[model samples]
Target: MTIATHIPLPQPLASLRRRAPGTVAGVDWALLSDSEARRLREFGLDEGVEVELLHAGRFGSGPVAARIGRMTVTFRRHIARAIHVQPV
Candidate 1:
């Protein structure tokens, strides 16, 4: 018999600054302010969406840019921390 074990690969986008791009797994809405959540939603950042981490500022603590769909969006590191992604 053969068995498979599924391991969770989702991680915060901010933590993936040095890693490869991934798909949007989920958002930690509870960690974000109402405005932040709304803004992210407006940017089309949701589960199942493909995302690519383009760049980050010093020490990966500054603004982060991610390419989603046909557009590229830049946001603060804290906001990126609230987004979870599954590496592709």
Candidate 2:
């Protein structure tokens, strides 16, 4: 049997700012609330889905702009923090 190594841990979506644009990642639903999770799902931010950080709102790290699937969505910094993501 071959050995498996180097599994990356999930990171908060809020941390995506440091990453470059077009960086695709998957969401972690375990960190979100029922309603918040549902809302995100409606916006197509479900787990395993690919998301790219388009841009961050100007002034004080406000909202984060990202492209989920074919649609673009924005979320507050706090909310984004609650959502964990792993690079895809």
Candidate 3:
């Protein structure tokens, strides 16, 4: 018989997928992932990140574009949902 030590198991459910390349029409500043959150923090994509819908992809699934920090980023619907943003 072998003795076992109690160790907290990592929660797989909460783990999010890495960001992929895509475009969003007007991703609200209310959706981003943990890594994305960290990446955005420096770019003003944080809680105070400004948001504006530059244009929409004809189908509305857009390639939404927004201005965060000093850079402009575009993302699609699926990828956008993965990125959690918040209002300033």
Best by lDDT: 1
Look at candidate 3 and tell me the lDDT of residue 65. 60
Q: With candidate 2 superimposed using the best TM-score fit, by how many Å does residue 3's alpha carbon deviate from the native? A: 7.6
Cα displacement (angstroms), candidate 1, residue 70, comes to: 1.3
Q: Candidate 3: minimum summed lDDT over ten consecutive residues — where?
A: 9-18
Off by over 4 Å in 3: 1-39, 81-88
| TM match of model 2 to true structure | 0.65
Highest TM-score against the true fold, candidate: 1
**What tens digits encode model 1's per-residue C-alpha lDDT throughout 46-85?**
9999888888788767899888887888889889888999
Give the count of colliding residue pairs in each prediction. Answer: 0, 0, 19
Give me the overall lDDT of model 2.
0.67
- Can you write out model 3's per-residue Cα lDDT over 3-81, one digit (the tens) per residue? 9977432211112122222222233344656665555455544333344434435553556565443566765554445
CA RMSD, predictions in order: 2.1, 4.1, 13.4
Please, what is the TM-score per model?
A: 0.84, 0.65, 0.39
Clashes of 2: 0
lDDT, model 2, position 20: 42
> lDDT values of the candidates?
0.85, 0.67, 0.42
